[model samples]
Target: MPVELVALIGLLVVFATTTLLDVNMGAVAFVAAFVVGSLVAGVPVERVISDGFPAELFLTLVGVTYLFAIARDNGTITWLTSAGVRLVRGRLVLVPWVMFVVTGLLAMAGAPLVAVIAVLAPVALEFARRYDINPLLMGLMVVNGGAAGGLAPSSVLGSLSNAVVERNGLSIDPGLLFAGSAVFNVLLGAVGFVLFGGSRLAGVRTSAREPAVVRTSGPGATTAPAVAGSRLNGHRLATLAGLVVLAVGALAFEVNIGVLAMTVAVALSIASPAAGRRAVPQVAWPTVLLVCGTLTYVELLQSLGTLEYLGRGVAAVGVPIVAALIICGIGALGSAFASTIGMLGALIPLAVPLLGDSTLSATALITALAISSLVVDASPLSSTGALVVANSPESQRDRVFRQLLAWGFSLIVVAPVTTCLVFVLPGA
Candidate 1:
């Protein structure tokens, strides 16, 4: 077979392989690209390897994830969640929207995965109890809201995407970024409200009991031994202060976020020896490995001309139809996998070539990506999904997962359908 045809086959294989397996799409992309580069495309293996790492993308994910972890240790996220819950009592219909704003803002501040969960889970549980609503219903609201938070101006993914685009010589406007994301956020929020919130409003409630043994064990469990680090004090203050400074500087001063985040880790480590030791164990290593592996996959895909093929194919077909479908597909897949940064990192670059001539700019693509991120947030397989289920008593897990799964798929369906009609139709 000819090199171009072989490369094309490889690209299709990668898409199918990743969709069925839990493997990183980036890794699939990298391997496919590398094979094509060597035997098919005739590009040098060394060049493929060099580009495979995508240092910027890796740094962006690692920095954001780590910074959020540190922030979680400081109890800042708990305070934020508590504040939001306090403000929106007894307003069943509006809970999703409120959750959206709070989580989105916290994500912007570089709050970590479990930090987002740890803080929001309790508040959601409390809210469900107080309002006599289903715990799972409320949990979905918080997870979806937190997932939607990735759309905010200062979110980890938003910042990373903006930097990548700008670094590639494309100018980006923050206003456009925020506006497009805001629209996407509102659309996804409504989906959650209807699927999850509407049920609660109609008087569906869960009978989940508080666990008889309240010992911490799983994901959001505060299971670690009650040591000096358990108490929030000077150590908390310094760690949080360092995180704020680093996060603010990265966004405000345009400093490298990864470096700033590492600096915070180092400073915090030195500030309180015991706390530093504890934080090391607390960081989510699986997520970190996933990020790195995914980056490798993305770079490989680019090298293999897989994305170029897709982009050119779309261009050949006419931008309107292809672009709309691509955007929606990206959203659904990203939501399904529950990693906005990973999906966006993998998708956006391939998309840039396709989108250059389309009506949607990088900002618009970012918006669509943000919508996909939110969709994933609401999915039952997401880390947030587990977080929500774990927050309730053992019995409510199955029921809650089912309800949220229904809502998640509904949003995935409604969001793209609506976009095709509203956002894409106008532009396309």
Candidate 2:
């Protein structure tokens, strides 16, 4: 069999072992990458490690989790959640939407999805733990909300897609693309809100600064004092300042978030050695291993030409509608395990010839493909979902991570088809 075919089979085996054994998917994927690269693909070990490993992503996970871990220990997260509650007047149902709108606007204003999630996920997930709100809902809200504005003219994702289209001499309305993405995410957020226990929070109310959260459901649903919601002190103030620095530096300066975050975390650690010690153990190391391993497999596949090979095969069928759906399918599945922007960059070019068929709408097909690619960022294999899993309360980490994976995989199965039916076929 061809190496590309072997690589695809290796991926299926990784997923099967991970799912059936209930083991870490990333661990399985990481091991699979090495096996396929060294034996089946006839590649060397060093190249596998160097080429396939997601080094920058690994840094982003470690730095973001470490900084947030320190903040959680020092009570900054609690204070921030308290302040957030005050803004919403104790109406917990609005909390997720507030997160949705805030993150959406930030993306529209030009913050990358990763940057927005890095800065906001800790506080948001902490709120989920304290108030009995579903972490899945809040985490999804944070991710989808940030992604909602992904195609705005000023946004990096939007600029990249538009540039690709322009380079290919294809024309699409940039503004319409932005609007379509925003609406799709907003609807997804609403669905998650209704499905994942958001309705249970409607009748619950409390003071924003009461220092306690009320549990509205389950066996012992009752008011409980907030964990680590202590009065502000010097260290907490310093941590807040570091968060501000992270936000400003990440969004405005476009610094490498991993480097900037690590810098901030190290500074905070040096300033308070005790807090640093406590925070180190709280970093989401398991999620880190998982993401690195999974992405390594993604890299392995990309390097082996498996993804493009699949795309080329589907397009070769020569049926425009079927070809369009297949492209969207590839985009969704590929984006779930890799970067959405990267998927867009790679797959859009493959669809250009299909657009040249004269019967198809370039804008609709591209827009469908764009939305299909992005809607799966909540996958654990992707950075957004990994951040959510990494930042969640340790006790609930496993449960929330499971929910995110299920949700993400479902999107992988359903998003492409749905987006095609909605965005692509309408213009046909």
Candidate 3:
């Protein structure tokens, strides 16, 4: 049996064990990585730890969760949620759209997609809890909105996609790519809104009367209402300042978000030891474990050449259009588990041969491929989906994870076929 096939089977088993036995997927992934890397791949343990484990992503998850925990503990999240509610005039349905637009604009302004997600998801989930809205709906809105905006002409994904196409000697309209991605995402977001109880939430409004003072139990806990005259005190103010610093540092300065976030979190901890003590334990450790473990196993698969093996198989298909659709499917499936950028870099080049046939429109094919690759970032295993899961209320995190997994897997099938039909067929 091919080693890649065995690794692939192991990956499925990890998911199945997690689903059927309610085991921590991350823990299972870690074990899988160790076993596969050691026995089958002949990779040393030291190399596995150094190469497979994603320390940067780990830091990002830890830092963001630490900061968010402090915000939740200090009433900053409550204040922000209440303020958002007031801004929407207590219209619950509009809140999700507001998040969508806000994240979209940030992405359009050239913010990295993950940075935008890190900045907004915690707040968005908090808003969902406060308003009795569906967290899945809100999380998906934020993710889709980020993707939509991330395809803007000036955004990182847009610039990179355009550069790749141009470098390959294919002419593409940047505007068309942006418009296609944005419209697809917006339409998808609307679908999520209606399918996930958006219409039911619209008529619901917060009471005019102030509710009793309630405290959050812990991370992912239900939040309490803010006091009538609640205001940011010194600690909350400092925490907010830290968040601003994180944003500016990440977006403008292009600093590594994980390191910068950790630096800010550490500073905040030093400033208020008591608050820090309370907040440290609230970091989403389970989520951290899950993300790190899954990604590590994915890295193992990459190291073992599973991805390349799969890519070669797709490229070997005979028909150009059939090959194109297969390429799109690979992109969708690969991007769901790995980095979308990495998948784009790998798969787009594979499609170059098909494009060279001169029977397909480079613009349409590339556009379809790009959107197909990107739209699956909502999968639970992807960074955006993991962030959403990490920030969800604990009681609902499992449900949210399952929902995202189902959604992501569905996209792996639907997105590629639909995009192929829409973008590739007409041109062919």
- Candidate 2 runs further than 4 Å off: 210-230
lDDT of 2 by residue, 7-95 (tens): 99998999889779989888898889889999888889899999989999999999998888777766677788888888888999899
TM-score of 3: 0.95
Alpha-carbon lDDT of model 2: 0.85
> Candidate 1 residues 1-428, lDDT tens each?
64545755665687578668856544666666667677766778787678655465345434444444444445543343444544554345556556666766676665654356544564565556445556765676566566555555576656776776666656657666656656665665565567554544643332222222222223455653332222446655676577568645654555665577667777776775544554554444443443344445444544454444554454455656456566566556454543556556656565566567666655555555556555556655454554564444334545665576566666676666665555455555
Clashing pairs in 3: 220-393, 220-394
Tell me each candidate's RMSD, in Å, in order. 8.1, 3.8, 2.1
TM-score of 1: 0.56
* Residue pairs of candidate 1 with colliding backbone atoms: 26-297, 26-298, 27-297, 29-301, 30-300, 68-111, 68-112, 104-149, 335-376
**What are the Cα lDDT values of the candidates?**
0.55, 0.85, 0.85
